[model samples]
Target: MQPWTDRTTPRPALAALLTDVVPANRRTLILGPHAPQLIESVLAHSSDVTILVRSVSDAQQLGEDFGPCLQVIAGALDGLQTPPYDVIIASDGLDRLLGYDSADLSWTARLDAVAALATPDAVVVLGLENEFSLLNLLDSRPPHERHGDDEWRPLHDDPTRPVSVDQFRTALPWQAEVYADFASRTYVRADVASAARPGELPTRLATAAVDQTDVPLLSPAHEGLDTAARAGLLASVPTGWLAIIGAQPTHDIYTESAHTVLTATQTPTGWHLTTTPATTSDTSDTASDTTGAAGELLVFDPGVVPSTISSGVSVESVLFRLAAAEDVPGFRKLAADLGDWVTDSRVVLRWDDVVYDGESFSHGVSGWVAQETVAKEDLLAAAWARFHGRLIGQHRRHPWPPWMVGDDLVSAWLGMSGVEAPEPTPATSPDTLPVASEQVAKGKQIAQTLDDLLGITNELADLRTVLAEAEAAKHELFEMKGHVYGLERTLGFRNKAMKTRENRIRELRGQLQKMTAAHDRIRDSRTYAVSRVIFHAAQVRKPKVVARKLVRKFRKR
Candidate 1:
């Protein structure tokens, strides 16, 4: 790997633009064919770096192990537990990402899959061959004649025939759009130059062009630069452009191999960009002002704005709209439940006159009335009696008069009953004695003869006493209830009258105060007006009299 240096004048300018654009210490993901020299140049300037490389063997050979990153998929992205990576470089990885039949991944599906793996704020850059470029046209030669690693190298071995750029363009519009939308800076093929200067050409092509191989490029973030001499001018750029340095003979525009570099600059409107040649091998620093600072570029891509456009329409709104358009029975029922209905007097009048009178009065007047109305009334009375029986059934289920077993029958009839668990019975006391005498024996015999009779007599007496007590209690309760009702009515009436009186008093007091204040104001105004008038009249008389007296005195003198 080589550090970035300026061998040509334009090289320094290009280096400066890149340096200004790339962020210092930020990681950049690079994709596509090898550009090791370019990688060296970028690393020389950037402060910190990480790289994701596709050439697993090369990664392993460099003593770098992927651990579980490439393999253990818990689901699709299982092995990602490897430390968080900063940059991912895929040289010739797009075909794989797009699911070349070998791997069977579609571009759209792969894009979606990778997006799920990436940070929401992560910057994603895709680089593809500019199918429209002049070099891409030249690289379509037969396999043996073409560059050893040409895109279709494995397909054909014909040494003489070459495929034109136009033929390739016909098959690849999908790849074009992918590159355009994602690439911040797209590289069009540039003519190859000889040395480190402008417009110079190499004298001759090597006899074994296939044998002459370029250095295997470092990963996209380019952390392999150790020396300054091999560093390309393109490497002078600062980090964060996600530099896509594509300079493969497979795309063949140059007699000598050189690459193109794209550096994206962030702007409020969109990404501003700088593109540069990736071939200069000069290591000495020419212009400090031209190169970007170590830490200046932004690594995160904010992605598309409004998100709706890039992601397409949302399903939630469409579903909601469809639901709104549907006249669901659920909504109808809800509306009915919420609505209010009122039966009017007009409806009652119509029912009574039209249905009731018309059926009865049309027949012989008295007979019709007697037969239709009276019979209907009798029928209604029978129905009412049946309805009242249900009320009686309620009473039977739970007798109304309270029972002594601690049960409230009225509450039971009302269905407001509750059960109280019985208390445990106390053990019978043992300390007791029995007494007997001649009189006791006579009493026992008397009780034996009168047992059932005494019970009947006692029951009758109890019933009478209960009835009388109940009547007296009812009368007392009625009187008390009446007293309470009268008290409530009297209190309510007094409260209302008192409030009215208080309001009237307040109004009268307000009026009296206003009248007194007005009377005082009127008296003061009248007195002041009269005083002013008298004073003015006195002044006028004095002025006239004084003038006449002065004149008379002067005449006498």
Candidate 2:
């Protein structure tokens, strides 16, 4: 039989949880029959791993394919009689076991069964589809179908049956680390935590490391937002949820690409969350001293007050100051707060980096600090303009407000920079005013000329449309003419065949006439008359005379 799951790659969320939360050496128990990639990932890390499938055939097939390294059990969760495992992964199959008919009892029994299979401190990873994703609101089809998985069969037909984040927590009755799966339910992109909390800031950046193949699950309209912002939005209305139960709290989270590292380190003074640069090294050039040099770090200040660290300050001092904060929880929260502040303040920072040409260069950092208060309307106008510009870049025909061009756009830009639009000055002298009026009249004449030109262009476009239609009709007529010509050729061939047949009939009639003449000649011959006269004389003779003639004839024979 074919594989039960269509997935070739392990779900991103599941992979993240496995790499970050579950220990490599732990004896793992995979409760559900998952994708092959997921099974391989679990088996690679854990020596004592068992997969619980629904049927004995599935177990036997998996065992034959994976060999004896993996133990496959064929039974229900409650029926399985095995030792408690250190980690239990239930990425799929749990939802089906927990039937949609009775959600409460199903969840309760499912959780109990799961708890029984796991050790007291085992890490339980549960994945569930979130019905309230933004894409669901925009589209009528199921999320799986929209993602190109048309054959995916859901346990419940009703969209409302799927558990929400709140419902999931209530059912589990545990403090679980919740993560939002973007692009699809299988890929976890960001952790869902209070945006107000500083500890969750790394998750925002961690989203940047998500595989680029996973794209705008919500819609193309959201493509304008950066990865971090998009991740936050996904966390708000996630496509799916990955709940890591009985897992330890994490202080730092690195993006999958490992380009950015967000660390929450505790100093002697206070707890500080810092986002720093993570560098990759090339060891091919051993002679070069700067071969493994790290990239420059840009630490955003989370405090309300602008950073005092100047460009003249030493890089070490700046790093030290960034490492010492009063009450930040995580890198993600700090980043989010800073982002929000930047949006509100309309303070933009532009940076340029200079790479060293030789091994003599050392790692250095530069800093910029600014604070500004902009009006709400001005900020809104500025944001709208920027967003509109981005939309124009993304789409071929972006919808723009009719009145928001020329002077309006300029005014918005000025207002966004916290500057008022200058008013027009009045003309003071009467002589200058008359000249200005004459200039206005000329401008009106020019506008009229432009209007006439526009009308002529429209008429030309219409004529082009008509000419294109006429050309199409002419081509069609030529095709029809070709078809008629072919038909005439076929008729000619048929006429030739009929003529040949008529000649054949005439030749046969001539042969028949010759045969009739030969038959008449054979009937009129003198030998046929002599044979008829002899037969008539024998029939008229008496029986006695005929008997005597027959005796004489017999004697002669």
Best model per TM-score: 2
Write one digit per residue (lDDT tens) for candidate 1, span 1-557. Answer: 01211121223223333344344454544333333344444465554443433334433432333332222111112122343334334423343221122343444444444444434333333333333222222233443554332232133232221122222223322221111111111221221111111101110111111112221211211111111112422111111112222212121111211123333322333223333444444422221111222112111112211111111111212212223455334323322221111111111100001111111211000000111122222222221222223223222222223341111221121121111223344445664222212112322222222222111122222233356668979999999999999999999999999999999999999999999999888768978789878888677857778789889999999
TM-score for each candidate, following the candidate numbering: 0.24, 0.42
Model 1 gets an lDDT of 0.29
| RMSD (Cα, Å) of model 1 | 43.9
Query: Candidate 1, which segments miss by more than 4 Å at Cα?
Result: 1-21, 27-33, 41-48, 60-93, 96-102, 138-140, 143-557
lDDT of 2 by residue, 1-557 (tens): 12333233334334434655777788999876666655776777887888877555667778898988898876556566777889988866365332122234344567777878778788888877666654455343454655543224343454334356667766675677766654432233243332312112222232222223323332332332233243445454545666788875353232222222233422342224433332222111221222122111111222321212112212212212232432223322332332333333422121111112121211111111122343333333433333333333233232225465433543443343444445555668755433223322322332223222212122222233356667979999999999999999999999999999999999999999999999888779987688777778668758788779899999999
| C-alpha RMSD of each candidate structure in angstroms | 43.9, 29.6
Candidate 2 similarity to native, TM-score: 0.42
